[model samples]
Target: MNGTVTELTVPTPEQVARAPKVVLHDHLDGGLRPATILELAREVGHDLPADTAESLARWFAESADSGSLERYLETFDHTVAVMQSAPALTRVAREFVEDLVADGVVYAEVRYAPEQHVEAGLSLDDVVAAVQQGFDEAVAAAETPIVVRQLLTAMRHQARSREIAELAVAWRDRGVAGFDIAGAEAGFPPTRHLDAFEYLQRENSHFTIHAGEAFGLPSIWQALQWCGADRLGHGVRIVDDIEVAEDGTVTLGRLAQYVRDRRVPLELCPASNVQTGAATSIAEHPIGLLTRLRFRVTVNTDNRLMSNTSMTKEMTALVEAFGYTLDDLRWFTINAMKSAFLPFDERLAIIDEVIKPGYAALAAEGV
Candidate 1:
């Protein structure tokens, strides 16, 4: 409300939900529908603390709010338990895409650790193929078209980084978009998987590393300098390198300056950061400053089910906290599209053809 009349008008939740969004850090196993989880759990004879879908959903959201990244991740055990088979994995993946499409996500990269899903005797290749098939089927069935790709993840504390990296490379051309390392970050560091990252680099493949969420600047430093991650998953800790004075003067340490100057995309999930204790709240999130400084800041949903969020919810929260207009929302969307692991032409086409037109129509509506 501080700008011109036209610029002062904030977008409504409905309008924000209609904006085309691009997601880069969503988790495949972390986004299952509550009903699907109950159904799968019953079919597989898995024991869940909550019997009903409503209670189970509430349990996940409450347990993940423990303000500890390790504790928050513990809730995934239930989601992953039912995803061991080809059909469960396929259904979860397809339903995930359908949910994203409904939330106005035009492009998304879903990441999950395939090593965790082979417990039911399914091979790693079978897991990846099933997920790809689900994505393909969902895209075909969506009322509105969406582009969905996969980022195969390796648990950082585990020794299968090299093997998972090889799997990602093998399936890169077949719906697998990139590779990533996810898990607890404090004790298990990215440097431990140097060989895997080196292999990916040698193969000319793209990968992201989870860093700077529960850990500090040192974690981000290692992920970028040591492993050569194409993006930083939840790089919220980069805010540690920035110092702001009471008089509004700002200064950045060497690492933060490098991140901004190089335009390294920060896949910041604001609500998830608060739930995991990386950020205190949305208003105090580093994305506000990073966006003002033109640091290629992008919003994301790290774990939708755990955080009880979607692209619409994330965007609506940001709009309420920062008073972001359609233009500001568009900036974040375009940043995600550009940082996508897809080819330049495909990304450009989505940005120009899909995202821009969607926002333009919303702006014309003046909501």
Candidate 2:
């Protein structure tokens, strides 16, 4: 009750809601529409606590927002349980992009663990193909075209890093843009997947590791020093390594300085952070400080359905909490575009010709 006024002078709600944006850390499994989940559950006879989309959406948000990683992850059990077929996977992937497009995201890279979908007796290749087809169809069908790519993920607790990395490289030209590993952070460090990281690097491929999340700098250090990640998926805990003094002076630890100097992008999901206990709340999060320090911080929705969030919603929360401006939103979008796994020329075109122009048009019209 600070009179709904913010200390940071953030942007208005309308500005954030309408800003053109880019997303790079979304999970396809985590973004299945709640209504879609109900339909698929009906097909497979998967019993759910809520038969309807509204109740299910509430369940997901409540379960995830409980501030426990284990409970947050349990919600995915229901989502993954329903997404066991090719058509189901394809439909979810397509709708994921359609939702992004509707949220003013011009470019996005959606990711999911192929292993999670194979319980339907399909091979990893089949799962990848189905999801890629969905992305293709969605982009083609959009009135405002969305540039979509896939990031194949390996479950961290499992031992399929090398295999999943190969899957990513195998589908490299087939719409798969990069490799990633998700799940537990402490025991399943990227060092466990060094061979995968080495292969991707030697193949001149890219990957993002879900580090510095539930775990801390050790997780991030392994992803960077041991595995050589191009970007960090939810590397929110890096803030733990940085210190700001009473006199407004900043001191960066060795790890933070290294990451900042290398321009390693941080795919920050503010709402999801609060949901998963990465941040206590949006206002106390280090996103504002990181942005001020010029870290390559990119906003994202780690999971739209699970977190009950969208890119616009994430930006809106940041605006309310930190008082970001339209320029700040624009800068976050550009940061995501720059940090994408796309090639330099293609990434540049997306930003220069597509993202900037789109934003400029909005600004020109005073939208």
> Model 1's lDDT to the true fold?
0.92
| Local accuracy of candidate 2 as per-residue lDDT tens digits, 150-255 | 9999998999989999999999998999999998887788898899999999999999999998999999999999999999999999998899999999999999
Lowest summed lDDT across 10 adjacent residues in model 1 is found at 1-10
Listed per candidate, the RMSD to the true structure in angstroms reads: 2.0, 3.8
Candidate 1 regions exceeding 4 Å error are 1-9, 68-71
Count of backbone collisions within predicted model 2: 3
Task: Report the CA-based lDDT of candidate 2 relative to the real structure.
Answer: 0.87
